[model samples]
Target: MRSSPVSRCRMHCYFETGSPMCGGGTRTVFSKRRAGSGVLSPVREGSTLTHGAQKGSISNYEVYLGALVGTLLGAAPAVLADNPIIQTLYSTDPAPYVWNDTVWLFTGHDEPNSDWFTMKDWRLFSSTDMVNWRDWGKMMSVETFSWASADAWAGQVIERNGKFYYYVPVTRKGSSMGIGVGVSDSITGPYKDAIGAPLVANSAIDPTVWIDDDGQAYLYWGNPNLYYIKLNEDMISYSGGINTVDLSSFQGHFEEAPWLYKRDSTYYLAYAGHCCSEDLRYSTAPGPTGPWTYRGQVMPTQGSSFTNHPGIIDYKDGSYLFYHNGALPGGGGFTRSVAVEKFEYGSDGSIPTMDMTTEGAPQIAPLDPYARVEAETIAFSSGLSTEPSSDGGGIHVTSISNGDYIKVKGVGFGDSGAASVSLRVAAANGGAKVELRLGSRTGAVIASCSVDATGGADVWKTISCPLSGSATGQQDLFFNFVGGGDQNLFKFNWWQFARK
Candidate 1:
């Protein structure tokens, strides 16, 4: 039995109408189906197994061999490599696509407020898990865009009429950093600015290009206005009135930076808000042009402070949010490191849980350094420890010494490799807010930022804290020996780590 590629999110199964023993098997399942023409849809059936087990027939082990879900993408299996993970695949912004079984994203090669601000460069990274990322060095440059003397903020890659188009925003001192267009032949490219003109400058920052279901095209800018345009058959030029969506209706919403996508007959309008520092909330809407609604707050999902800046990607039979979190580190807010969580539509027809990290979604492999790891309770002695209530499996930490130093051991899969453990610590007496420190090395603090914990108890939810100390690619971790707080009790469900 073989399943047919129905759409980007599903497969049209062709089965022999009998059980496996009857010389027949099922190809197409109900959960996913072929992406037919028009708006995408929810197949709803095959998603669940005999019990309440989630996940389709897809298996992680087979992913390496390029096993596929369906044809919606021609290069299906090629994109399923989520292991030997690529740490961070995101560049300055989120670039998405629907062709192969992966989402190919483009971003910058450096960070801001750092040393590499003036020298603008680009890179290409793709992933199916949205966890690990693959970095394809320097693809474009400041020289590619017309007025881009420096600063390539928000740029989008759109494929239409058989050609690839890259749209970017640039600025040079007094001259407003406007949006410029770049053209390329391959997904990875040395794109040249198309019109030799800013895609649309004067007040616009990040520029995005979205093609509608009708095959008609539109260009969205970062001006708090949903700019619309019709693509000339080649999808190279603009044709319609630049429509404006007055987001003024919502407060704490600014900076524009938008990405538009369509799903199940509805359009999802995603954009970053709040200051460049924090208060960032990744939002969505029902149409490209909208009475946009606030789904959830973005940035700094963990501790407080501010956390804005992000990009959204839909892949792996799910929609995932990719953005840099405000991890308490030397450059926490400014680092702009990438992290991902499955973005699901909430019950009220709005965005679902934006709990910083998508807590339980099958942890996918990543594409860059600060490689992602989960929290688990693998040890227990005296003192105290935190473990997942849902699945009594993971790492276990017990207090030693003065309850200041906590030791953790792998539980579930037995040290797939020497795992580096990070403990999410909240101040014993509201000390330094709440911080995350590594327990392995004597005195290392990875992320010093803290956030809204139940507060009553010292209990904190332990997650795969990014490795910050040493170079195993773990993020926001430095072996800060976990413990403290009179009520140092916290809720730790899982621990994410990569066994080297």
Candidate 2:
């Protein structure tokens, strides 16, 4: 059967009014574009990395909001994220590719290892914020037509020149099964195969294309002979034709699905070894096709369709891994759901470390709810590097940044003037407003609605003016701060780490 194609945000734009872009006085939002829309304001300086507190490489960090900022005016604190940038998508075999701020996940909506492609269908889901998602519904199915039918497996989606192409893997009744090519002008569409036949049929089951520097592209696929074929400018087929290699050097066992990409000059090939069952063991190689060296196990979630089929993509100067895992919380169906994690590259450029957490890690938080709704928990920078700053007399803030959860506890407050000490913040540039919590040292947040910003993306936010600290010392605060506009650079405020 033919297959289909599939397809963050910067921190820093959360403060409103008096932006440096606006010359630090007063300006409304009409003068600016909304956050995460990929629109950016001309930078107005003030975006340097200022480190006031740092002894060494910092470890971990936290952010929290309790009910205490106001007595008469109380509101709920915003939620923090944990790990696994994206916990799940509608289907598995998740192959994610980034386009603009949106993350496109093309996956198969069928049962895991079902050996049934006839019943299988493919779908596409999109996310602008990586937190909230927009599902386009069932995209293509074996039942969709007559030319192709059944056993849809692992394939890839790539855009070249102008159009999008979907390379689908399937098991034709008589033919052993290879990748068939499909075409669509839009990422989400009712696509039709290119040559009305598989692009490189019978080459390998799982096919993925990696476009390298020098305008050259290579196809990575298969089992015994991990294969490759340079793609033409059209990206419809191979330029130098399909090339196959023996993946013996690398410890690829039962290896099938393959995903490859190049970073700097290093080409990375990540594939699954062993059967993709619940006890699935994942491994990777350094080069696209080579003495593929074996790394440690990537996942062990079990084959409820909860296996590893990684699709690596680069966006906003960072790398992310898109794969699958068992969605059956009850541990039943081989239901595969798409998930993601931030990637860490090693010094020697050896094997990379992927940070996966039940909580969202490697992502900026207090994200726009309208954005892609990902996992709830987030991974924060750890260590006592800095604290939120505060007003000299009331509450003491030590360090501050975007999307951090700080813990506050040292001072006792009078419930009466909650509104006065309610903790307010505004960007040097005019943006938007929101309810910030200046929680009491007691429970969670009491009096709320204090701080507000535009949830600025990559563009950095400098807290030239901040809430004052309490007369008492050591006020506890959770760092849930965010920095940068989606397109700008992400930097934090001056952190008073452990003091001078």
Off by over 4 Å in 1: 1-91, 112-119, 172-174, 223-228, 280-286, 291-307, 326-329, 358-500
After superposing candidate 2 on the true structure, give the runs of residues whose Cα lies further than 4 Å from its correct spot: 1-90, 111-119, 143-145, 239-241, 252-254, 276-297, 300-306, 329-333, 352-356, 365-500
Model 2 TM-score is: 0.53
lDDT of 1 by residue, 28-104 (tens): 12112123321111222233321222121111211222222334545443222222121221124555565567777
Candidate number of the best TM-score: 2
Count clashes in each candidate, considering only residues at least 3 apart in sequence or on different chains: 74, 131
Q: After superposition, how far is residue 455 of candidate 1 from its true place, in Å?
A: 60
Model 2: per-residue Cα lDDT over 1-500, one tens digit each = 11211100001111232221112322111111112221212211121211221112221211220111111124453223222222222256777777756778788764433322223667676654454333444556654434455666766787877678777776554656656777788878667767656666653567887666667767766653567787787777676666666555555453556777777766666666553232223344555445555555554433223135777777666666676543212111233445566666567665454423333324332232122221111222222222222322211222233333333222223222222222224243333221123332223442232233435432333332223332222222333433444211122322221111
Error of 1 at 171 (Å): 1.3
Q: Residue 374's C-alpha lDDT in candidate 2?
A: 18
Error of 1 at 167 (Å): 1.0
Query: What is the model-wide C-alpha lDDT for candidate 1?
Result: 0.43
